[model samples]
Target: MSRTDFATIDWRGRPVRIECQWIDPERGAGTPLIVFLHEGLGSVAMWKDFPARVCEAAGARGLVFSRPAYGRSTPRAEDEIWDVDFMHRQAHEVLPALFTALKLGDEKPWLFGHSDGGSISLLYAARFPDKVEGLVVLAPHIFVEDKTVANIEIARTAYRTTDLPQKLGRYHDSADSAFWGWNRIWLHPPFRDWNIEAELGTIRCPVLAVQGIDDEYGTLAQIRDIAPRVAGICELLEIPECGHSPHRDQPDRVIVATASFITNNRRQTP
Candidate 1:
């Protein structure tokens, strides 16, 4: 694993520290940049070596970061409750600020996002059509579904009754902060109406959406719905015998498909 670093950016009128790391930096400036966005409860440490493996296969540079309230980055304030538009805020405000702090001016990156991160990538690409080259999203939610809610309920129970918190503590500095921040927002009654299907039409870059056939958190409709809505090329892949976390469950297939998709759809430079 690469050594982790901190990038401080101004967010919500306060300084937020983002935990980040680069994979295959030696691949040089001309190579494509793939930014890895973790799932709702994920952090930099939770991703393990998946980013590095993907970057190595794709011959691209990779950036893996833990958003606020995750990993070693700043934890959410105890009294804070994320609003319904939390994902939107991350896509529009936090991501851009991180880019600026990292000195990534005008560099349109390829986004590799999972779960909630996947939705954020779509939102960012839609909001800033010219700012992204391509996308690879895994088990992303376009709309809230009953299955999703049920699974989240199960997760809440597991977090309380099982050793889930201890396991998550291995990755996040404040497991409660990370878990509750994501859990409360997702399970919020108002969030049931949250959907990004209408906003996808604005995306101009090629998208590769992947989902596991046996994913317990969401169904195939999540990726299938993306095909007709996106303005640009969109491909869908369903892996058999896999769950929500494809990178962990079926790493080889996900890595190969992602690398190939990026290679095929990479923007041609003059």
Candidate 2:
């Protein structure tokens, strides 16, 4: 396991702490650097050894971080409520600040994002096309769907009635901050119209959009709609017997596909 480090940054006028880790300390400078973005309720610890394993397989350096209000990072203010553009703010504001704080320099990273992280990766690549080399998104939501809202509503129930809070507490410093921040924003009525598909047209980096055949949160159209909009190549991977989290459901397949995608893209990068 990689040691966690803290970086303080001013996000939207508030000083927030972010938790980050280096997955491969000995990777060569020439190797591509990958940034792993976790799911909505995921923290650096929730990702566990998956990032390290994938980095090892791809022979790349990896950086995994917990967003503000999640994991051991700064917790959300008690009265705070996330707006509809919460994901947009994270992509446009928080991530740039993180890159600056980490001093990653001019290295163009290949983003490996899952769920909400995948959406953020897409938004980031769209906004800063030159900073990203490629993308491998698992179960990304280009737009909100009915099924997604339904699942999120169910999650709300589970969080309220079940030991879900206690379970998430194992990974998050303040489970309510992580869970409610993501859950409420997603279930908010206006969030139904929150879509980033139009922004994707600006992305020139190669994209590999993965979705499970039986994803409860989204349907195949989530990735299918992405292929035609991006300026660069868009590859789709539809895995059978997989659910919302492809990395956990089909780790071997995801690792192999991602490794191959990164290698091929690296050779093509100028």
Candidate 3:
């Protein structure tokens, strides 16, 4: 599929830009819509073509976009360090505002989120239960872990010493600003106290959670904590030999799992 251009949306009483990248299949006109939300350092370009593949397999429409302050969207302020509730803002405010602005809220959309995006998906589903069809999360984080902090520290080192930032620049307009803002907030002392397990109970949609068994940043505990909290249904799938980014490490497995999850949920959901 050819790449789409960037678009802008005014938010927070300011001109906060965002990119909407989607794959519209010809097979079905009213196919289910699944919105793709990227990880902490991810952009629409970094998602590569996984969104297209998943949508093709499931016969669904995909709405993939870069959030504000990431990718080709607006850059973050130099002094900005995200709060632990950053996911909350994305879920409750940014997402709703964007969907409404783009007139995408008319159709209920499923959420496919990874890492920080996964947590944001959870928050969105919990806060707006009626607007969600289902959720497919890849390597989501609901609580902080020591291993997560350790890996984040390593990423900081890599960004400074290696070509990580330069490589990210190929995908994002202001890769340095996005990378540093996310890194600093995650590494901050106050963020260490962050946890949102309490808020997940409000999610009344079917959830299909996937995580790699070998994930360096998180363990099964993150999904385990929210599995029982959800009033809807929650199914956890652990992919073997997979790491932090399951979609990157095991794309085929993720595609199959997500496709099946959406298909099965849509048919039987109440």
Return the TM-score for each candidate structure.
0.98, 0.97, 0.95
lDDT (Cα atoms) of all candidates against the true structure: 0.94, 0.92, 0.86
lDDT tens readout by residue for model 3, 178-209: 78878988998889989889888889999999
> Which of 2 and 3 is ahead in TM-score?
2
TM-score: the better of candidates 1 and 3: 1
How would you encode candidate 2's per-residue C-alpha lDDT over 171-223 as one tens digit per residue? 99999999999999998899999988899899999999999999999999999
Ranking by lDDT: 1, 2, 3
Q: Would you give me the overall lDDT of model 2?
A: 0.92
RMSD of 2: 1.3
Q: What digit string (tens of lDDT, one per residue) describes model 1 on residues 42-69? A: 9998898899999989989999999999
* Poorest stretch of ten by lDDT in candidate 3: 1-10
lDDT of 2 at 202: 98
Q: Candidate 2: deviation at residue 188, Å?
A: 0.9
lDDT of 1: 0.94
